[model samples]
Target chain A: MKTTIHLKLYAGLQKYASASDDNHPIETGDSVREVLNRLGVPPDKPLLVFINGNRSKATSLLQGEELVKVFPPMRGG
Target chain B: MNSFIGKMLNVDLTSGKIETVSIPTEWAEKYTGQKGLGTRILMEDLDPKTDPLSPQNKIVMTSSIMAGTIVSCSAKLAIATKSPQTGTITDGSIGGHAGAELKYAGYDAICISGKAEELSYLYLDPDKAEIRSAAELKGVGTFETEIRIKEMAGDPQVKVLANGPAGENQVLFSCISTERYRQLGRGGIGAVMGSKNLKAVAIRGWLDVHVPDMKECLKVAKELHAADKIDDAEYEIYTDGTPILVDFSQESGLLPTDNFQEGTFEGFEKINSASMKEVRAAKKACFSCAIACGNYLKGSKSDVEGPEYETIALCGSSIRNDSRDRIIEINSICDDVGLDTISAGAVIAYMMEMTEKGLHDFGIRFGETEKAVEMVRKIAFKEGVGAEGAMGTKKLADKYGGAEFAMHVKGMEIPGYDPRGSWAMGLAYVSAPRGGCHMSAYPIEAEAWGDLDPYTYEGKADLVVGLQNSQFAKFSMGVCDFWPVASDNLAKLYSVTYGGKWTAEEVDIIGERIFNLQRIFNIMAGFDGGDDKLPGRFHQENLKSGPPKDISMPEEAFMKSMQEYYRLRGWDDKGKPTLEKLKALGVEDRFVQQYETYLATS
Candidate 1:
């Protein structure tokens, strides 16, 4: 049986989603990098990524229902 | 004796006359330097209602006191004039070696007035100034023009600011290209120059920058540079340049796709930062900058400076072209043709919209790279259908009867960031004296990262006001925005650089004064509260994707923010500065009296 996790995006990284809300699901037991890869999110796209609001490495393991968020570099005055 | 070169060179291109005047001490004290001083000088000389493209309009280029000094990122030049685009006061700041070279040439500013009878260029050395006929140099691109001028001057160090075919043809959005790549890219400064029949200004000098205290300045600069590295956001900008924002904006649903019809583009990944990194050949640096964020990308034919964040956003996703190589080509062409990337892209996007709606048949389609290239060349040359499009987005949109989706404010095309995606930026766009500008205030940093909710309209009024004030101060100092200057540090830099004892509060007061003065200039030019508005689409359209899906900017919220902003600015409901505010800033009684009359009627 396959489990699913939720993902959120902030700032410039929100464009990768087909949906409007921040509750997209990813396959469980996948690493953060794997999840992004599956969703067509490039690994080098974001400067920082977060899991459940905490900064996490791309290789970090993901569990079902885990909330992942990603942010890109800021470019405003 | 300190900081400034202490002279202004006035060149009458028509008569081939050159004159030098001593810099007024009192004026320097009041206006600070660069943008502020340039505006004050321009206001004294030109009538507010005069046509911007007329020969009577002055093209004043001023360097700040810190420009040639070892002050961090102080190599900025301000180009000020009545704007052909907005019909109001406008100035564009460009980062390059030209301003510093001008300072070294023993002038704080170069003020050029009167129309030349024929093509001409100003050649300046440390000890001499001459007006030379530019017949031989006509029809050259900016890069070639700069190289030719340097060859003529017999110095590789000679800095040149010139126009390309776009400016030569008086394209309304044409830019004054400086140091080959850097540009005074807004409000059609190049068109103003072109109208004067001025082709270029080349200068070389060996004079040193005079600093009051070199050791103290160096110490502060080192500390600021160090702090900038630790600031992850600033650090990334240094490494990746602005193209890094491409991925984020795409993912965040603020990429401005299909003439801003959609919030995101499908082909974003192919043209983003990672791809840019793969093609980047070397890093480039501007004068006195530590962060060296500029990247030189190797093209199949030639190496070119990057399509930065603004370029990528405007020329790529905004128009649905996702090929990085094509974007790079577009960027190089804009530079060569001397057109602003933002305005050019906006105009092209408008053309695409017109084509899609069957308004005209110009063979422009989304993702048509070859057509885009041809259009750029045609616009530069003012040939065929490109002639109408060359007039800029506002005029082109008006011609096509699509002013509703033009995405311009005060006749200038807006930048890449969609206002509906960022309310404070939207307000900044409308109220900016120069029209549709991002440099006045960038609220995205605070809006995204501050404790306040990014989606909420609450407290955005204060946020926009603060950012505007700070940006004014930054420009007055003539430094790059990438510096890590907190309020306290900025106050210190101002005091030390100008010999004025300024607290952060005092600096903020100066900022408020400059901002209000610019507003007064615009008001006198006939813009008012009603003119302070965004495009209809931003106010009505819903985001088709992203977290803010189905979200449209609320008119009521925007109005409330405007009200709060006006109140905070001490301006009345009509957006006129209050008498008390002017008096508090020590503005002269004569101007204050005139403002009072305007306010009473308003």
Candidate 2:
């Protein structure tokens, strides 16, 4: 079954996502990496990825209705 | 005397005596300038085991050979002292008109020793020096102190380095504020200044730096300017300042959130560069900085200088709060209180974690902006529980039973990035001479740049070591890191300005030597391989998000990487420089023998 994953950017990464891109969705079957690849987001970017409030890697298979968030390099003191 | 002012001003606060001493030509040639020269002076004069806050612990403020010259991004100064936080050599750099003024005032450095019996401010003009009573300036914040000093000096051109209540209270992470917002922020340098009972230092000058080859130097400056303009990605940094990293860090999941329990924040957009531009009243510039990154943001209540990357991350995302206005207010509070924002935020975050775990009664709920502001003020004034908070993160965590979650390296609070997420930064923090610093070796650039895999730990060791070496060189030269000039370009600039044949390789060698020297200092201070470690949380807690989900940094792999790093650095198994390596670097046998004796005992 096909699952839809929601992607959100935090802190400085919001520059890459405008109002039009809010709550942007990407499709994947199971793995998070496949979803990122399908969404055209480069995995090489300094992205901290979270799946459903827990830290997960791109290789981790996704469950349906997972809340996925990506962030850039933090500048906070 | 071609590049240097040839003299150093020694101020004895105990006796109110001020003397000008000629700098030895041999010392200048051996140590170069700024951090290098400052370290050499400290090693020669002060005992290695001297108490950091004692009157005997000298505060060496020095400018580089390039400073005050018509060189790009030379408006930098180094404040070197035994760190109260780390108990090791610490040097913090600040960018402003002050370093230039000092160089123009015909001095390469100012050596301050001993403590004043009463509060005082030093006004150093080009020809005269005075230690005046600072009765009126007592209890004043850095911003107010700067304004008052400018007014009192009767010269608006004077550059003032001032401390706030945090310093007066001897907060372990208190910073010296210069050019209003720019800080010599790490290692409690302000506490050292405060211990001296020095309220402020105001300097003014009209002399110029005599460049050996002005035409060639100017050509290089023009090239640097051109390069800055053409590089669209880097050039944008000039417009937005460091807040630009807010979005980048947030997206990368590197932004520390909820006391670094998670890597991502929910409300990053409200605190990023776009929001900053929306809130700022005007853009500001430091002395001779081509890229004016300083933002003067006006909130409803006050007009503050910034909510830079560290401030925004620590005050904003780290708490799961995204209000730019609140962040700006807190940033202003830190500036006014003369506190380091990074440490302040870390302490608050530690408190939040404690509160969440039922460890203590802090009354600080996560995302409570008002409480955050209140706590910042209280910490500054050392009021009630704020006293513990002002002592810094490690101390606060120790007061409660939260050593595992203190989020500090070498006693100083860690910056915004959670090391478990980024291995290179973790290494940088673990091995950072001044403790838990991002700027010492910002591996984030290498980690983020190009089509390389950011999540993989492959090839990070070499990049981190190289960057650390280069950053040491930058610190030695006393140049602001914002300048895009590479080491090669800098070598050419140095060659032209100093009338010396400085190749890029020679520059790298100097950097390596400085890095090793710093390592030796830390080693001599009793920091061993055991101290080169992360907090328990980083090693044990698994990352819940990102590409490396549920993967905690394996200590074995990390230790191996460190060993490889040491080997690459020409050090022994215990992370000390080998005899052959020391001899090759031209380090005298006396230092080597002393270090060996210390190592054997430790």
Q: Please, what are the lDDT tens digits per residue for candidate 2 over residues B1-602?
A: 35776788899999889999988865665566888778777776677788888899899988888887777677688888999978879988888788888888888888898999888889897789889888788899998899999898888889999988788878888998976787885888889888999888888878888877788778877786676452233244555678877766655567888888777677877888878888788877767777667789998767687877888888888876788888888888888889899888888988888888899978887888889999999988889878878777777766678888888988888887766656788888887888888877877665643334555557777877888777777777777777755678768777877777787776766677777777788888778667877788877887676544675677788888888777877887777778778778766567778778887787
TM-score of chain B of each: 0.96, 0.96
Each candidate's fnat, in order? 0.23, 0.09
Cα error, residue B53 of model 2, in Å, equals 1.0
lDDT tens digits by residue: candidate 2, A1-77: 55555666544444555412434455445666565565555656545556665555667776566777655433222
DockQ of all candidate complexes: 0.17, 0.11
Candidate 2, residue B248: lDDT: 62
Instruction: At residue B435, give the lDDT of candidate 1.
Output: 86
Q: Model 2 off-target regions past 4 Å?
A: A1-77, B228-234, B449-451, B588-590, B600-602
RMSD of each: 5.2, 5.0
Assess the local accuracy of residue B249 in candidate 1 as a C-alpha lDDT between 0 and 100: 64
TM-scores of all candidate predictions against the true structure: 0.90, 0.88
- Model 2 scores a TM of 0.88
